[model samples]
Target: MKITVTEDQAPLDYDQDQVAQQYQEAKQQLWRSRIEEPSLMRLIGDLRGKRVIDAACGEGYFTRRLRQAGAAEVVGFDISERMIELARSQEAHDPLGIAYRVEDARTVVPQQSFDLVVSAWLLVHAQTREELQEFCDGIASRLRPGGRFVTLTTNPDVYFFRPRPDYRKYGFEMTLAEHVKGGAPIRFTMHLEKADLEIVNYYLPLTEYQEAFRRAGFRDFQLHPLHLAPDPAGRDDRADWEDFLKNPIMILFDCVKAE
Candidate 1:
């Protein structure tokens, strides 16, 4: 069955300066620092001399990391101009030779192919399978033959199969409609220290994600589980992370463009 997106299900905008700043702060949350970032960087191993694109690179967080990882060239793109402004400001303050641009991931026109393309929390915004396909296709277009695409996105299973408030302990909660299905809106509320941040993401079934990657000339599409980074303090916290580990809210998607 085809799922139709209503106006209320539209993707949230991060164009406002306040929204962009809040989002940047949200990225520093514990779960991201320990799980999401390490997991993604592990998947994108050895960036030395590689040309990379950080698609939907809000505030150039990962973009700067990519350059620091020794990527020969790195370009970051985000749909929000304010986000780009923040990224550019950082670039000015600390020159990493990274380029920032404002572009929608789904319709990005690739000027040149890259060795790798990484995006975090980008695909979940697709309101429909068609838009998801477009986003996949655009990512594929930006990669050279045999280049990889890695993204961190909402775990469909966590939303459709196990919607719960347990994640609130980890500083976020997902509110879902009683009748969940493809394209259903997912209200994600992040409990920050100062304020709560809410964003909308659409649920696309695993099969739909497979189809989108297959149709976009990608092969060996894989879903990778999150991994927690070692504690900097060397203190054991497995007990505290058990709930989150059992039901991870975000996961990594990895694939390679056909050579």
Candidate 2:
């Protein structure tokens, strides 16, 4: 029922059944272990009384987190059916009232729908600049005049294709065949349960994102580059955390719609 991705193949270049269990479990584990996840939470800020849409919400983790953080309303959606199924199932049992739907983030961007919109590592899927624009347009469309959209992304500066001591220290590797400015195929090798698996991503340049955000009517940007500064209160204490500071992994970006 599952197909595996070969070395010659793109990562996660498999059928839905694979993601149904194996890939998802690995991703979820990595989500907790990685430095980027906690950094994402810090970027999110206080959610009290805000209406949030968790675009590309995989497994509804953040959706429920948002609701628990006292968000006035929270809705989540994903393009993958299996991811949505897991999200909905979690919601049914936990009863967080977080709505989950199977829809691409670019579509169903209802006008003035939310006060804040967030996605976790969702921008890397835009393999083309045009697709990035459309995705930002959808995000902008869903926001009210003063709404903000935020997401975590791979640092465009780090050519993931090359080896990094930091990556190895963290127990995984990232590689790409070549560097393409606008978009390029990238892959993440995740080590889970002592086995290695790879997942595909796209290298989206910050410049491209700036242009897309501009076209989407976003007038301001706040990007938090990890590793430059230490958050005194941050709890993630991986052995390679210092190594992460040197090589840098990812960043969180926030863009605001003009009033």
Candidate 3:
């Protein structure tokens, strides 16, 4: 699945047709609804009257959701053409005025600066610091000065991902080893049994992300680790909710581009 890269470019793994298809279907399932979407929506606040770029937006799931949630304008971009195609098809069936395009978040060519840019599960693929900064810079490039940016990312701490009964039942496992120090690269594998998919992500210290944000002229950064959203009173049968609090899978970032 490796593709030729320029001397300065980072390796990308999202362009595969099968991965794109699997991920598109995966997002529609219950895990996305209960686990990540609520936390993500809360972190981004009200999108009403704001133009938003759904960076690395897969299959336009959140893109359409943003529109339904009151965004004035929504545009979604992903590196995979297959993803964009699926998104476009969904948009065609039920047009939400969302525009889908193919573009890498690390090198996006935005049509116009956005009031807000939100990325979900996107930055973990950065294998190097420069790639991480490029992601931040690209986000900065797409935003108006003083624009807001929100992200859901892999928690860098790997101490919680050891083999466990819970992981197997959930159909995914994040395998980790000796932690690499000094912002060095640590490759982590997330194997999804349900999707029959395996995803590789980079694990770097949180300081590395802060530096990237600072270097990209982002300020007032706030990090919120993911927590389980409470269910309605009717659904009192909350199984496996405690694990989300104990070993939160993702961290949410709320940041602003410098004016």
lDDT of each: 0.85, 0.74, 0.75
Per-residue CA lDDT of model 2 for 1-259, tens digit only, reads 2233443565452236555555566656543534555666677889888999999887777778789888889999888788888888888888987888887888735577589999987887787889898899988889999898989777776774244454664656767655466556666777766456766777777888999999889988878865233434685564536666666656788988988
Clashing pairs in 1: none
Better of 1 and 3 by lDDT: 1
Backbone clashes per model, in order? 0, 1, 0
Which pairs of residues collide in candidate 2?
Answer: 161-176
Quote each prediction's TM-score: 0.93, 0.85, 0.85
Quote the positional error of residue 218 for candidate 3 in Å: 0.7
lDDT of candidate 3 over 1-259, digit per residue (tens): 3222232445435567767776665565445677789889988888879999999898888888899999999999988888898899999999889989989888845635799999888887787788898998888899998999999887876544554225544445555545554433333223333445555566767888998999988999898866456665557545666665566667888889998
TM-score of 2: 0.85
lDDT top scorer: 1
| lDDT (10s digit) by residue, model 1, range 146-203 | 9999998888886645435368778887777767777887777877777777877778
Tell how far residue 182 is off in model 2, in angstroms: 3.0
Name the lDDT value of residue 141 in candidate 2. 86
Off by over 4 Å in 1: 1-9, 108-111, 160-165
